[model samples]
Target: MTVDLRDRHVRAVTPAEQSPHSYFVFADGRLLRVGAGSTRCDPIAEVPSIREIGPGTGEGRESELRLYVHGPWVCVTERFGVNAALVNTATGAVRELSRADYHADVSSYSIGFLDRGGRTLLVAQTRWNRLDVFDAASGACLTERIGEVEDIDYFHSLLHVSPDSRHFLSNGWVWAPVDMVRVFTTEAFLTGYEPTSIPVGTAFGYNWDRPCTFVDARTFVLALDDEAAEHPYRQLAFFDVPGEPDERLEPHTLVSCDVFPRNEHGEVKGELHYDPESRHLVALTDGAGAFLVSPAGEVSARLPDLMVGGHGGQAGWSYAPRHRVFFRWNGGSGIEERRIQDCDRAEP
Candidate 1:
């Protein structure tokens, strides 16, 4: 499939997550739900999901608040040592919860609200080597168990709930520094689990610190380490989730691209975004343009001169599928709209 850059455009403003009828924009300690309350270039009506923090008082440092949204639940939380809540969409009901023991150490980990079937009623917060799932509806502990990483620190680690909701996978090097990645079930986690309760990916890796995700219920994709010493490239691998509980795991290289660039500090300056709609993986960078990678993990197109951090740092871009358009923002520049005729990724 092929993508033409000539059909795209850019803009300058803050980006947001676009739900069907609402535009969810976030700041440090704040979340604004914008919707059909007005008619203009941007969202007119705004609702602060956070109403109160402590004893009817509304005050806190932006640096101390962490914001996230899942389905109709918008979570505005304290960095580590305090409160967390799930904000409802329709009636704006706020469900407050506790994040007291969330071992938010040194920041690569993420917390997600877990849903059973189609209902989201639990919260999953990654702690030391285990994940603590809380009752989002009642602010109670649902369950907890050992995770893939021995030590998932405060910096970059990988944990993604599968789209199919069957499994959740994670990988980090801080703990045992082993090549094996971890996978656990959503049901076992929501229901309950033991210390020795095993999931899958029992022996799933030949590398470390690489990002991976579930391709389906029984298969997944991983970005292996760099290939060249002189010019580094991101090599991707595909592996089948172990069939039997004791089956050995195997991963084969699928594709590679030198899309990862380093900053002056030599740190990776971009983030990889998987577009399920296009079946393409996009590398959005702090330098250069976006490299659209195929499902096979090959770089297919490069749309340069555009500013995007995927959903990194904060919400910087919002894609509206119904409108086939996306908005780009950078805080200073006003919002720009780009039209997408199709993201079919068809070959020219």
Candidate 2:
């Protein structure tokens, strides 16, 4: 059965922000905040000069600007990690991140807020095979040269820090162009405890840039396509991080579903966001709309159409656990909020 969770609609100047409880839009030197269920788009602050810094070569960058909003904090990073800045929406203070040389392929560089509070920042230098951690608020380099000395062939990209901020997941690819999903202790790596990379599941030559969301501090869900040599299914696989260093990480197929909306080369054409309150993964596919999939792999409900932007203007989808709603921004002048209360009809 298809369940539609359409709730309310709000207007925005730019589809620039996706955080937990609100939508932030940056336009005309101003930052606007839209609460999850409110129609008011309040002008939060006169945003300082946080411009896009880079060669702007437009050679292989994904988008000119990427916004990560967490509570009152905002981090804007160039798509290729050439430059970035951390902004406090409440105070109007800005901290510019250290710049790096541009790399053509986006998989070469990634920048994002590592934890749920937007406190820790991570810039993956895939070209150098190293990860840099930072204190987001104070602009202090917490640690550098992480995974740099490891004798591995993985170009680390697509970082996702767990809810408790204990584990870190990287959906990076390798030379043969295979998508390798890895998990490790976030604290251990930053503190020089477990400097070596821990292995997770690998999907050879399939499911590159697919979506992943953490169910908790120790378990995460990963999307993948069929690859007989590895996880042989177009499904969402749940994997648990080993508690002990000697334990092994394994992928368990919680449910079977199509990993669709793939591009020409069969890459990810969608995103996955988990709502802990409702206990469902919101699968936002580019052209195919959105689906509410349970952890047991059942399609509880679906909204058949979501305005996922064109080309580089892809829609940003996020869930507000406070309101139990999924927000979709299409880089235009409006945002959509869909309530998942109808999902209660699905089995718990």
Candidate 3:
């Protein structure tokens, strides 16, 4: 399905009811609001309720709020002190998934939501380097363990699950300071399993963050940062899952533009979306314009007049097979629904 960018309209949600930092959209077109402020879309009955899952650093600054949706259910994770919750979206039900009792010194964490068979699973990573899973319906933990990490803070990274719900992927640092991508199977987890690293050089190193969706079970893309510096760059790289030995994942610098300059200190400040069905990759950058890349990594379209940028947070653009409407998030603050019209499927 090809979306017409010209027929789109954009609007911002009221800022008073939103948290300046945290926001998420549910699968059913309902928005899961967050942050320290109250939302006009308050008391989201059919959506997950936001509450202080853990203790904060005195002033109660929330670290992260993530919403995971599968089918009709949405699971929300609110991280504060050392606790988190797995809430049911269909009903206003909340259950504590983790607390300070699990990891005393846990100062940071990440959560991944996956649907295994007919059940929903909530996986939590504590600041003390521990991974735990809980039943989404009952909040009963199925497994827990102290992960293979000495310093938990360095483990800060992104978590993504496969479309098939068979594999879970995480990118972060473990024993060493080098970046690593680890894959775990849901089937193995049910029988007491842990993630295994693909290979040595398969994971992108130097600097990497902001993971886009999985192009397939084996291919995924991430925004690259400079190798030696802390700055980010407008570069994309593709690596085979279960990577081959000596395989080096390098950035595609040809995609960079004048706004997204290729420098040792430039960062890829924007949002990325991968359309699985059409094999289209859309990149919205602060410095550059909105660009569409073919599955082969060739530029297909660029909308420079609609240059919009921010922290380049979560921007939604998904193909609704049922509705036939290509939905997109307008600047991460509002949504723009566009009807897909007839367009040539030939590669541009």
Candidate 4:
């Protein structure tokens, strides 16, 4: 299922929750459905308001608009403010979820649908270090962290909910901006959370910010670059999503990648995706190319010549589980699909 979207000039894109073959993309001044195996961009609806607020648009100067899609629901949010909206593509209904106050910043807060069913919404504060869950339908706060901790900010950034919806991981930073990763049990935190009293999940120090994806409900992979070392290298570390909030828990295994090219930022810039059916991890990079990695720290397949683009920030580089293929902008004139081959599958 390969779809060439190089000419589309996508402003924002997110993988459709149910259909791996299709993606919701904002391009050509409208919201359209771009899918695999074909190059046609199907029109969904005219979203003039959404388009105007998106990056590079009139309202985007102050903040960037991000999209999160699951099933029939699309959650739109501003990168720097709490203002958010939930759109139902099925019914063509748009609902304003929250309006921004005045105190939002890079570390303010962000919103996303918490579960696959789109019943819950997750509100995480990047600067204040608070997490809140809300009822998507009623717009009611379901659970929230109470009793704030002064001067101890977790600065939660990219939040990854486990496949089972039992836990979540925050690939965020701390003071002085040290990239740290933390995991938390969803039920425990939501049941009776007190920020000062609760033991937040295990915190891993020095794991610089790259992209990470959950392999399963209890396991995930984190990207690491030994940048300060004499010979810098890229590595992927695998960890069991800790059952308790133990800060000392370390990655059970690590996969060392071949020394490869780097982006202008002096890093192997890319995104990580996991195939649940094949149980494999795929790391796609713009400069160094892509690799098919197993859960057991094995490099099963490597495509070194594949130069990718449109990977970071609001750019979309995603793996569609339904088609078992990776969809990414070629950074040129095409959207390439990299399918995970079964013959290359390695046992973990």
User: Candidate 1 vs candidate 3: which has greater TM-score?
Assistant: 1
What is every candidate's alpha-carbon RMSD to the true fold? 8.8, 6.8, 9.1, 5.7
Candidate 4 lowest-lDDT run of ten: 194-203
Candidate 2, overall lDDT?
0.59
* Strongest candidate by lDDT: 2
Q: How high is the lDDT of residue 247 in model 1?
A: 37
> What TM-score would each prediction reach against the true structure?
0.64, 0.75, 0.62, 0.73
Candidate 1 lDDT at 42 equals 26
Question: What tens-digit string does per-residue lDDT give for candidate 2 at 236-297?
Answer: 77888887773446786556786345566655556787887668787777776667788888
Arranged by TM-score, best first: 2, 4, 1, 3
- The residue pairs in collision within model 2 are 3-301
Measured on C-alpha atoms, candidate 4 has an lDDT of 0.58
Question: For candidate 4, lDDT tens digit of each residue in 1-348?
Answer: 233455556666666778765777655545567665445666665554443342322234535556777667777656555555566777666666543342344432445456636465655442346656766556677664346534445566556767778777666666665666766776666664423222223333444445678888787877765464564353767778665566445778667764234444445456787877667677766665567767665667766544446434324455555567666544343345666663254222
Q: What's the residue-level lDDT of 220 in candidate 1?
A: 70
Which structure among the candidates has the greatest TM-score? 2
What lDDT score is found at residue 298 in candidate 4?
Answer: 68
Clashes in each model (backbone N, CA, C under 3 Å)?
A: 15, 1, 6, 0
Model 1 lDDT tens row, 180-203: 455556665455542322333323
Q: Model 1 TM-score?
A: 0.64
